[model samples]
Target chain A: MSLRERYGGMTRAEQGVSLFVCGFTALLVVALLTGGLTPSYTLYLAGLTGMYVLLSLGLNAQWGYTGLINFSVAAFFGLGAYGAALVTASNSPLAIPGGVLVGLVLAVVGSAVVATAIAIPTLRLRADYLAIASLGLAEVVRQIVLNQRDWTNGSGGLRGIPDVFAGWPVLGPLPGELPGLQFAEYAVGIPGLFRIRVLGFTLGEPFWTDLLNFVAVVVFVAAVYLLLRRVHRSPWGRVLRTIRSDEELASALGKDTYAFKLQSFVLGSVVMALGGVFYAYLVAYVDPGDLEPINTFYVWIAVILGGSGSNRGAMFGGFVVVAIREGTRFASDILPARLPVDVPVLVDVYGAIVSDFGSTRLLIVGLLIVLVMRLRPEGVLPPQRELLWPSALEETDE
Target chain B: MALLELLANGLVFSSIIVLASIGLSLVYSIADFANFAHGDTMAVGAYAALLAFGVIGGVGPTVLALPVGFFLSLAVGGAVAALVAVITHVLVYEPLEVDSIGLLITSIGVAFVYRAIIQLRFGSNPVEFGIPLQRPIDALVPLGIRITVHEIAIVASAAILVVGLHLLLQYTDLGRKMRATADNPSLARVAGIRTRRIEWWTWIIGAGLAGVGGGFLGLYNQLSPRMGFDILLVVFAAVILGGIGSVYGAMAGGLLIGVINQLMPAISNVAVALPLVPNVGPAYADTVAFLIMVAVLLVRPSGIAGGETT
Candidate 1:
């Protein structure tokens, strides 16, 4: 489809969002061309966004699809991260030598086990009970990590984590083996008036490694997305959606709703752990801070804002979350320079604000949640289309 | 011994938890949603009392090691919290036409907003009530209870508030209306009770108690932006332990949970005495409450009080 035709097909809100995204992408490209943003850092951001996308998708499976209020997103994510960290970190008390593969397996298994343990007691109760119970679980896990110095190194955090592809034969030394390429050596504009000197942006090992990580996440997201799309359009997915809308109705149909809910919970948690696994390799460090309840809410905001039950919306929400997080950091950086430093109190106040701008993000997250629930609870991109088996849908159409 | 000291400490702590739990339980029942912001409401109360205490500045004669002005500030804190909650109800919860779950999620947002505003205004660091710390009462110290006059004050004040609430619930016309509405909103409305008005009063009473509890919590521990949020789960455990909507049950649960929380070290010592049991540290105190809550859900979903509020 042509750009104009696709654009014409979109709703008004979609058109506006598309325009904003396009503009942002253009700005980012311009920055990259002008050597304003380092290639490695940009790629890092991309990988991080990809990780969030995975998280949102996982949440969508449980919340969007099944209507199970899983508040332990960060816990599962932490399980994934610590899974990888415990396996691969040089100072790991459990020095397992299976590299990233063991980490991935551990992440998935750990999340599933924890999810089951939490689900059995609360899943049979009211939905709000699950929310409260999951939150408690997150706290308990965090406490374990914070106190178990023998295993997790307590608050000191784990270090010397190898890259996601450290054990692979070809990819292990790939970044070091890649050739450096310089960009924009010559001026494109007027020779003298707006002479652009040698931009000379060199691609190094960091860029290559980040590029590999970004590629890995893209592949991971694509696989998960395809799997979700397939399942989401199946009869099983329909049952989940039915349960989300009315559990009584689904149960009346003789569907094992409790079993389905547990499956959904476990699957979503495993997906969330996958995000944490990627995060472990992306940052190459694991800390107790990763399990903060606030992190779970961030994914919550993403899923809800993007439109619950919509995979595409979840992807969009993840990007929006990263934008909000990094955007706040960017603003804090520039804010101090523009503020009046003449008055000592104002100076101190702004300094303090700029220093701890994470709370500013918290305020925004809070306001966004309240505003979204108040104004647009369906979210920005609520699932607009119905899901069904393609052949069945085609037959119906005929 | 140390066990007595811990028990005494637990009593003081339970007083704070009971106060907070009553508010949460009341709102949960009347509002028909888990108000996650209730803890933050307590924080709001504590911070407001902090500001009030700063303004009032120890002006009058002492009462239980706290100045009369401190009590006045505590009242101010409660009033401010109630007002904040009422405004939030009108502005946010009333206009929204979603189910209880939506409100629960929104309340989380409300919680973050409250914490964010506090953090913005007064960094994330812990602060004190500016009340002079007193020596442990000599008689109590001899009994192996090292609690101070301020600790005594907290328990006493909480008792007074709880008694007041009980009286208000059992005797008053408003209390009867509230009970009716909570029992069945549609029925209460048909009977010509203004359920909406009763709900507004519920917010007032619930948030008022929470604010007083928050102030006492500040006195018990250092006041921080996260002080209320930190204790939120413990209060939640209390509410769950007693049936969720039961006010009297919340009081009982809060007392038990609070005392248990303070007795963590003693419990750990006892565990060490056992052959196969590992010594769980005091850091896992909240975890124990959470486990108990889960166990309660498995055993008796209606709670120990059997969901009877009166």
Candidate 2:
């Protein structure tokens, strides 16, 4: 009962067409989000969404594809960020100069190490136990980072993470003649377009760090999306799906379910670590506060809400979460201006209340999670099960 | 002896854990899912007690009516906590049904909502019963050992609650029905046992104890929105160690963990006292429950008191 067993997977031509449409739509959304409403802030949000897209994609690989109840997203992400920090930050304990590429490698390696160590023993546990174990381990990871004062600087948080692209020869010089803040370059050529202003808006480009980091993120996200789509459609994806649907059946068929589960877990963690590295590089800072357990839950929410098994769905969920979380910051501007004849006293109270509407946003997110799971448990973008080979069902129906 | 001090401290914490873990285990056994929000139930209890005290504290005569007022606040706290816990199960969890993963995730949502509500209401700072607190009961003892009145009170109350629960489970017909439902719900239902009613009672008792535990815990530790979360993790450690479903196992396991949380840190502090070892700091001690939970789970995933494993 495979989609491949019915209709062969989407043809290359079909895939090409769909990819173009998705890309075009993504571009339009990016434009809408980045223009007029709060360009710099919107850019920051976009960069963050890209980072989370990677995280959710990683979670999708583990939970949606393999049915492993891995709750180590925050741990792996923190490790990645700290891993990057160790190599790249000015006061880092390590000797490595902050070459962005080297930091990424360290993050991926560090995440893999922790993932392997945690998975070796706990992978044998039932799903609920695994959840507990992973969650506990994540706390252990956070505690270790905090308590190991000599190593992690006692939670003051590492600073001065070198910008990965600011020093590049050609593109680095593009933001030339800037003073004080080295990264914020002035507008050029495009006049009003480049020099556009909004609340707290700066012209020309986002922090060169954000620009380069986001570019790098886009590249990574594109590569990962393409790669996941390929793997998800391949025979390997079939095996993972088999394990997800029925581990015993997969094991019975000699799929080595344990090994596969571990692989899926490590794979997901590695991707998440890469996200961590990107996040650290984009922000140019690392802190234990950035790696709370709540952040991991956010990634899981994104994956489940978007579409658990679908890479594109994961990205969509990432967008929705970031918009809800970050979009609220600019609500006063966008929301207040649009309101008709607001009561003066109530409006003042509303303004005061909306100043700290963070919990309000999360409440909505949480309510949406309950509602979505209750109504559309499969998510907004459920995974399509098209087959690689022409399916027998399709042929018979034809 | 320092050992006695640690033992007192251990017993106090263990009793609280005992109070909390029994409910956690009960839910895990009969309902068949790790109730992630169980810890929040404890927080709700403590905060509810705090609220009740705030309302009732001013009305009572200071000398004659304070104790009565305190007990009333405690009851109010426990009841409110239990009510909220039941509401969570009904509104959030029961809707998810047998989709355990979905229920689990939804519980995480519920935890966030609970924590956010507490934060919004109480703010981020820790709150306590501002009344001048008592010194250790062993304060007057000549052995140079100290155990606070709060500690003694916590331990005594825990013991009473444990005994009361034991008696209820062992001597009562409802207890038999609960045990039967927990053991085999389908079979109990076929035998004309009201399994759903038993489940309601199970949640009620579990949440009520959790609330009571929280109320008492706030007396010992300063109450905060995060108090339940930290305690809940440790309670989970105890529950898993005791074997998930077994009530007796959870009690013993809580005592074991409570001791380890306190006594082991005391031992480590002593070690640090000896000149050779450097100071690892108190935060290092927090990892014990997590380590023990993982290590115990590795050796005996079914726990020391084997619970249902499916």
How accurate locally, in lDDT, is each candidate?
A: 0.90, 0.79
DockQ winner: 1
Best by lDDT: 1
What does chain B score (TM) in every candidate?
A: 0.98, 0.91
Query: Could you tell me the lDDT of residue B238 within candidate 2?
Result: 95
Model 1 agreement with the true structure over B1-310: per-residue lDDT tens digits: 6999999999999999999999999998999998889999999999999999999969799988788999999999999999999999999999998899999999999999999989988888999987778999998777898989999999999999999998898899998998888898899999999999998999999999899899999988888999888999999999999998999999999999999999999999999999998769999999899888878876887888997865
**Local accuracy of candidate 2 as per-residue lDDT tens digits, B129-184:** 76567665544466655876666667877888889999998899988888888888
lDDT (tens digit, per residue) of candidate 2 on A1-398: 59554234564433643565477457646454445444445557778888899999899889988888877799999999998888878887655775777788888988998899999999988899899889889988998898786787758878898666767776566544343242343333465555542233344545544565667789999999778777877888889999988889999998888898898899999989988888887777888887778788889889988777878778887877776676666564466532256787766545543555665565666677677777778887777643343375467657
Weakest 10 consecutive residues of candidate 2 chain A by summed lDDT: A179-188
lDDT of 1 by residue, A115-218 (tens): 99988878997899878888888899999999998889889888898887876999989999999876746567775668554466888888888898899999
Q: What is the TM-score of each candidate against the true structure?
A: 0.96, 0.87
Question: What's model 2's TM-score?
Answer: 0.87
